[model samples]
Target: MTGIASHPEIAATLALKRRGITLTLLTTAYFFSYMDRQILAILQELIRKDLLLSDTQLGLLAGFAFAIFYATLGIPVARLADRGNRVNIIAIALALWSLMTAVCGLAQNFAQLLAARIGVGVGEAGSSPPSHSIIADLYPPEKRAGAMGIYSLGVVLGTAFGTMIGGTVAHLYGWRVAMFTVGLPGIALAILVKLFVVEPPRGMSDAQIVAEGQDKGVIPPLGDGFRTMLASGPAFNLVMGVTITSLIGYGHAAFGPSFLQRSVGLSMIDVARYVAPVGAVCGTISAVGGGWLANKVAARYGLHAQAWLVLALKCIGLPLSFLFYASSNPYVAVPLYWVSLLFVSSYLGPSFALIQGLAPLRMRALWAAVTLLVINLVGLGLGPTAIGVISDLLRPAFGEDSLRYAMLTFAAATPWALWHYWRAGVLLKRAGA
Candidate 1:
């Protein structure tokens, strides 16, 4: 045994059964992460009423407060992942965030809740960068897109379960109980991840190096990672594209339930019931399909395929997002929402794959952290807050229908995001050629 396969723990992970198990466990951890992050969206209304909070404040809690620390801290944590045990980092993050999420149930005032949410963000900062690095090591370049796509399914599944479970529990036992219910399971998940998942040597999946028993690479300095990203036009555009996409996606996610309830006259439970299943099914299909399609295209046409695929999806999805918000009838609007979501959500796997593929092996986690920092800051930090402020501004004119139009206003960003994706594709194609 040599390289990654030489380590006793990693040797077990090389077995097909253990590899699949690791992927499943990591995906499950991701599932819990989103559930903790997103449960607030579904329960925002209840929380607003109970705590006497405004939509803007709620948005800050959902978006800015969490995103601020999450984004800022991710870079350093990812630097740790580059040189340390990624599995340990992920497990510790899972436990910390989960504990904070549970603490949210104990908050009696706005300040306390905000503090708890910030703690949750700090913990979650450690999750994705390491997970992405680990996944990149597990699968070779040719198969990475699809593998990433499968892992991305955790987003939709977590959102779905969060909405459904949070809505139902909140309706019955109040939002506090819903928070507690969703947060505790992640602690157990963390323990499992720490015990079972083995860290593969960096660049283990790069065939040329791995087969020659030289998979390990020196961890580049943090500044070098930033320079690598800044020098690559395609990578920068991809980051911009993802950041904009996240803006629209997070804005819609944060406000969509409220819009449906206010404009469509559905209850919170009704919104969850209808939106969760549709979003779950469509998001899963689109995420996996996008990765599979990008892989196939890349196989034939080369490195730019994922960016091209993302551009196409955004183009098709943008108009449907407008229609989804504009329609009055729930039946018509919900189906359109599903189609729009499918297109928007499809980009994750390909986008992550592109980021990892383009990055230097030593800098992959750091680059991922930097990309996430931008995405969370621009997207998660501003998206929901912008919608909330806009909705409040339009309330005088549109009354209860204000949220609907505000979402539509945000939806217009889709085309702007599409342009970035197109630019990214062109840059990638030029670079590859």
Candidate 2:
């Protein structure tokens, strides 16, 4: 057993089934994390009325309260993951966040909710970096995107369920009940993860290691993750591209329910029934299909082709987003929303798989952590807040129409993100892919 464990190539066939189980459990964990985080979005209108909080306050709860701790704490947590037992870290983190999510339902005021959200962030911070590392070790570069696409479905499915269930529960009972509804099940899921998933040897999936220029057994210093990421021009651009992309994506996603309710006169029930289901279905197709499509493109053209694929997805989504927000008609906006989600959600698999491939094998978790720190701190942390502030500024002029234009304000920045994707592709092509 020890001999086989030491030899990854020899063990690959035997480990294949375990790999599937691990990925499934990890993806399910991600789903719950996102669902817990996103539940507040569906319940925000009710929360606002109950707590007498402003949009800015809600944004703080949604963005700052969560993203700050989630991003900052991730660095140390990821460092631990790189050297420690990733399964234990994931299970412990999942349990912590799940408990905090339930606690969020018990909060009596903005301050209490703020603390609970922070706890949720702290727990979630430990999840992704390690999970990224694990996935990278389980699948090679060619298949990584499709695997990542499957993993990224957590975001799509989580967001869908978050809105659907949160809205339904909040509509029938109250917001507090909705929080508990999504929060408790994660604890049991955490246990399942700890029991079912086994830690694979680092560098198990990679067939070579010229990029690291070091022994695979040597644990590189923490700074190596940052240096390694920046060392590659394409990788740097990919990271920046995702950061920009997520900024706009999180903004629209967080505010979407509010926009429909406030502007289109859709109720919570309407959002759950009419909007959430569309996003789930379209985003699922995009997430899985994007990875599969990028893989086909990469196999035919080169891995660099993925950049172009993601760029196209972003371009398609940008116009759809503008039309979605601009239209006052529910019928028009809802369909546009579905189409926009299809294109926009597809970028995740292609881009994330690229970043994981770019990182050094031993330092993948930290590399992912550093990338996430930037994305969450600047993108997720500010996206919702920016939208809220802009909406507030536009409220006097646009009145109830402020959120629609506020979302559009961020959607215009999609072009800047697309430029990064184009640059990343150009750099990768120059390197001969």
Top model number, TM-score: 2
Clashes of 1: 0
Per model, how many backbone clashes are there? Answer: 0, 0
Residue-wise C-alpha lDDT for candidate 2, range 1-433, written one tens digit per residue: 4555567556555566689998899999999999999999999999999999988888888887789999999999998988888888999999999999999999999999999999999999989999999998889899999999999999999999999999999999999999999999999999999877877777767757634545447778887788878899999999999999999988878888999999878899999977898789999999999999989998998889999999988787888889988998998988988988888998888888999888877788998899899999988899998898899889999998999899989998999999999999999889887
- After superposition, the stretches of candidate 1 with alpha carbons farther than 4 Å from their true spots are 1-17, 209-216
* Native-to-model Cα distance after best TM-score fit, residue 252 in candidate 2, in Å: 0.8
Candidate 2 — which pairs collide?
none
lDDT of 1 by residue, 21-48 (tens): 7788888888898889999988998888
The reply for model 2, stretches above 4 Å from the true place, is: 1-14, 210-214
Query: What's model 1's TM-score?
Result: 0.95
Tell me each candidate's TM-score: 0.95, 0.96
Each model's C-alpha lDDT? 0.87, 0.89
**Model 1 Cα RMSD, 1 decimal:** 2.3
Candidate 1, residue 41: the lDDT equals: 89
Give candidate 2's TM-score.
0.96
